[model samples]
Target: MKLVLSQEQRELRAAVRAFLGAASPLPKVREGYDPEVYARLSGELGLSGLIVAEEYGGAGAGFAELAVVLEETGAALLPGPFLATTFAAIALAEVPDKELLTAIAEGRIAATLAQPSIDLIADEVAGESATVTGTLAQVLSGMEADVLVSPALTGDGVIMVAVELAGEGVTRTALETLDLTRGQARVELAGARARVLGPRTEGGVGDRLAVALAAEQLGVMRAALDAIVAYAKVRVTFGRYIGSYQGVKHKLADMHCKLEQAESIVRYAAWAADESPGELPEAAALAQAYVGRACFEVARDHLLLHGGIGYTWEHDAHLFYKRAKTDEVLLGPPRVHRARLAESLGL
Candidate 1:
């Protein structure tokens, strides 16, 4: 029931924040994906395997720890395939793929989950593998991923499978998006072979993803609020600091309240993912329902508060705005989560 982070978790946050500050400053993040940076993040910082089992060469942590790391990553706007890889790891954990988990923990491969947008078909299955054919319209980190875990429609039923991206029947094409830091791709599989993972069920992977993303949106809100507040303190208009304006003050107060509420919900959602699975669905829905729109509103205000400079490509305000807007719709918009929340509440 304690929503506050422990001392150790605070230290973890500090460490991650410091590392990102030094390694992934805004300029570096603007440079786009870097393989070496991701390598150090995985190998040196040991974040790639932070939540995998110790026996699988990971830190053997839980979703709480992962949430802490993600909050920092979001604040830093760290680039590359870290989020996608984590999603794949979570999916594999549900099915317990020893070799795949080990590879992810060791940073030997990058992976992603095929979203529902990608409707794959598996018409035939022989023994442990299936011939998969379909096109994933937009895959997060698809360009950099080495493997993909997805649900495919089969004659028997919907089943989960893992496909190697580097295989013969697979092709990938990069796509432009609002969030340049997080790249997307188009994947086409012409009867590519895939290893069966397990039978598809009503697992909480989607809910877990919502919670994790809500954590990131919380970080975005924090960073945006802090940045605008700092700017208000220094920037002057009509011979007075912007912070002295009553309108700005009210907006900032509202943003702070939203951020605090979002943090509370995100923390509870992450906790439920780790300690109370029964509460995860409701908690995740609540987190996304509130946090997504809150983040977008905060980011939008953060940009507007900065005036015209915020619209320029040179300023970092647009970056936060773009990330917030993109993330709002990443797993469906805030309205979708709100509906989910309503359904969970039996309303």
Candidate 2:
């Protein structure tokens, strides 16, 4: 229940912010949403090894560190496979295949995930290489990925498989998205090769991914809240700062409170995912519910704070706004999270 961050955590946030400021300024970020920029920075920042353990060419940091780093990454709006890659790392961490983990931790390999198909089952993951056909469109940084984690049928159930992006009969194409600042790509799988990493039968990857996506939502919540707070003070209205207005101040305060609540759940969810994977499905769904809607609301308020100018192409608020909406459906909508929460609660 402690609201304060540890000294190390605060330092981590500052260090990441400083690094992004100097290494990848907003001006540079505005230049393009190229994943390569983030990819290279991932190496320069040693982020490729973020989730991998010391035994697998990583710094051996836990998900607490992942949350911290990702919060910074979200604030900067750095477009890359960061969330997907790190989540992929979680499954890879359990992989007996040390070579694959080493490749990603060493920055020589990339792994991104796509939305699970209609056939993807939340439970029952086990067995050998499976068959998967069709395509995943709008995969974040999918084209640059060396691997893709997808759900495929394994006998009576569906499970997660790590497929080589360079596999035979696989095709990749870059895409333009609603939010141009984030890279997207289409992946066509026709007789694509696969490696079974983890299964729902053993450890439900479908739920695991929901947990990971929730962590990223927490990051987005932080960024949108911060951006709106910063905007409120500087933006002028009625011959004074809009932040001084009673209505605006109250609204911003509500956003801050909601963000704090979401942050609490985010920390707990991250802790659960790292220290107690069993509690993931419920914890993740809970966090995503508060986080998903809170971020969209905060970002929308941020856009409105800018007045008519908020609708313009020049403002960064709209960018965050768009990204927030996009991420809302990254794993599924808020309604999906709510329904999952209800199911978890057995109601």
> What tens digits encode model 2's per-residue C-alpha lDDT throughout 10-112?
8878888888777666667677655565657567777878778888788888667777887777777776666667767776554445777788788777788
lDDT: worst 10-residue window of model 2: 118-127
lDDT of 1 by residue, 1-347 (tens): 76999998999999999989998999889999888878888888799999899989999988888889999999988888898999888877778788888999988898999885439998678777999999999999999999999999988888888999999899999999999789999999999999988887677989999988888888899999999999999999999999999999999999999999999999999999999999999999998889999999999999999999999999999999998998999899888998988998899
Best by lDDT: 1
Candidate 2 colliding pairs, count: 4
Show where candidate 2 strays beyond 4 Å: 1-3, 33-36, 118-132, 154-160, 196-204
Residue 240's lDDT in candidate 1: 100
